[model samples]
Target: MQPAVTERDLNQADVADAARYLAGRIVPTPMLGCPELDELAGTRLLLKAENLQHSGSYKMRGATVAVGRLAAAGQATGVVCQSTGNHAAAVAQAARRHGLAAVVVLPPDAAPAKVARAAAAGACVLRADGDPHEVVRQVHADTGYPVIDAYDHPDVVAGQGTAALELIEAAEAAGTPLDALVVPVGGGGGAAGAVLAATGRGIDVYGVEPYGCDSLARSLAAGHRVPVTPAATLADGLRPACVGALPFRVLRDSGIDAVGVGDDAIAHAFRLIVTHLKLVVEPSGAAALAGALRVAETSTHRTVGVLLTGGNVEADLVGRLMEGSAA
Candidate 1:
């Protein structure tokens, strides 16, 4: 038998260290229950509301942790990062708090709301014509402070893990040991962390990806990181082409599977979440719940955890989408 692939397993100590690294900075996003979601899925569904996070997503956790770590090490000049949306806002917000300058490289097609928010948070925003990921790399190479990656860095991965750490703890306290933890996979930090945390707690983990851009799913099937080709999806935050190197290592070693959901399902989830839950979650953020709704046939449990990652969609876009299909 092949030696069990146990390389990316993270221990309690590692989780504890990550928690401490983000203790007083990032918001402790709440794990919430939805009877409607439960009724829809025929299983109890708990939503971890990272949309309420300070920067409107769990990206802030990783951005804050990585920047804070650099600051503690006396390398805090300023920070540079790239994003289609949430990660730029995250880096801007965290950089502001850390007393560091922030320069964000954003795609020309990034959400207007997020672009303005990043500007409001005091980041020098640059519009890039090429790929957002490549722009991130170029900016990092040119700037010296530290690059706050969207999902690939070890520090970012560690920090993103805290969301699951907090979620599981809260779930246990409420007497609901999660049967599965589902998370959106853009560059894969959140899903990677969810797998590490959920498996550690003996809960199954699932990584949800957009059919418009299913990097994690493609990567997993190919047994290597794969870059996603351009496609049109409203999940702006899920537009990254490839899973992050560090996060991919964790996902592969942990044996977590990826689930692909169509844009229609994600749109439906957006409508359902906002109409029923009164929470305006971004399409990428809602991808995990979309997966749960579609992946129940593969599961063996009655309860699941879904990371509601952000609520940063543009109002006009939401209006257009809602008018089209109520999704």
Candidate 2:
């Protein structure tokens, strides 16, 4: 396995390199837009539809890179990871593709669809009610499997950045350069990647979190990492109790703004995305749009980019959300 990469070892150039490495390997999900949605936001909104990405989320990019490295090293027989949902599924799928045994530790209350996806990809799915990180460490120690951190690993961050890199490039190609970029923050991996991808490009990056689950926002305010017992919210994927150490290192003093969105706003964004964009975005992904609309309200950003991070929500939840919208 590779040595652990420090934040000092990562930079915008790494994101560029990751994009190159991922070219033709991961899905280049389309940059989509809807006039009605844009009009509602009062700006030109470019949505990076990572919900359409492989493994049903942008997490596939990072999982593939991290697992591919382990496979290439040939020193490890398997891989282990812990996540609320998407990362586990992505790592499972990536390991399967690379012919590596995979074990995923998830919370007992993890989304059913997400759990099914990981199992479907041939991973040994385990449930732990306690801290998943501790379980991951134990799994690594016991099985000798390299642990692919969902948000902290440098390669993972670099891989996640490719999604934002593609979005920025697509926006430029379309002659509507983005003034800002918005991404949902769980452990802040994707947001940190966004900061890297938009560096030197003058695009302001915003990390969105569910209101009571806003560890990133709270950490920024505290000027250090602050842990929160995440509250119940529609965006289950955004419920990490703390922003990841590596991601915090990348985001601290990076001038990236943090936005706290509520479940009501997330639900509204979900409705808009489904109704106008015709996309099956999970509430966690919808938080990006909710945060983008908030940014549009307070800033002069004419062109904004939002990364719709994933689409692996439960079917019943979708029906309930849609039904709620109709009522």
Candidate 3:
């Protein structure tokens, strides 16, 4: 197994601490009960609409905790990171809150709107050529800024777990029981966080990834983290080449199961969200709902929480995806 995250960094205690730190920084997104989805799922269906979250994604939660730690430790000589999109925006916003400077290295192929948004968030956004992942090293070497890996860092992972923590707490307050949670996987930080949060709570957490980018699934089967050349799918945000070592061990050790879905099913999920739920979710966000649908057949869980991770897709892309979908 890959090296585990230190017990002290963003462990259970740190999760609580981060929750307290983020109470005012992040909004408590709703657990929207979709009756239409319930019918389709043949059970209680609730969505943790993190698309409504700060920075328009759950990354804000992790970003806040991670940046806050860095800032407090005086490691805040500014921070640098490479992202396809969402994580950069999250980091920019979080760094701003802590009065720290931020620079975002974005892949040339990243969505234009995402690049613009990151720049608008007070980050000095730079377009990197060639290998996107290598951009992190190049920027770090050139700028001497701390390189924040999108989903590999322990504090970030713990901060992401706050979403699950809040969702589970909300379920209790609402007098509803969360039998399971389904989250999308790319770098697996979110899924690892969910597993960490759900532990000993009798809630099963499962991760979903597109068939085109089944890095975590491949790694899980191989008993170690593995790399793959992700095929470009509609869910571009979930196209990481590999699951981070930290998340890989956490998911496996926590017994979280992962499932891969085809692009056809993800398109169907997009239709479901748009027509029935009336939510504007990106293709990557829709993966959680699609995974819930897949798990429903085999899972005995009644009330499954599906996390809509973000709503950052461009309208033109949605229109293009909708054109091919008969649903």
C-alpha RMSD of each candidate structure in angstroms = 4.3, 1.8, 3.1
Arrange candidates by TM-score, highest first: which order? Answer: 2, 3, 1
For model 2, residues 1-327, the per-residue Cα lDDT tens digits are 334355366788878887877778889999998899888989999999999999999999988888888788788889999999999999999999889999999999999999999999999999998988898999899999988999888889988999999999999999999989999999999998889999999899999999889889889988999999999999989999999999998899899889999888999999899999899999999999999999999999989999999999988889989877512
In model 1, which regions exceed 4 Å deviation? 1-12
lDDT of 1 at 196: 64
Query: What is the clash count of model 3?
Result: 0
lDDT of 3 at 67: 83
Positional deviation of 12 in candidate 1, in angstroms? 5.0
Per-model TM against the reference: 0.92, 0.97, 0.93
Off by over 4 Å in 2: 1-7, 325-327
TM-score top scorer: 2
Local distance difference test, per candidate?
0.80, 0.91, 0.83
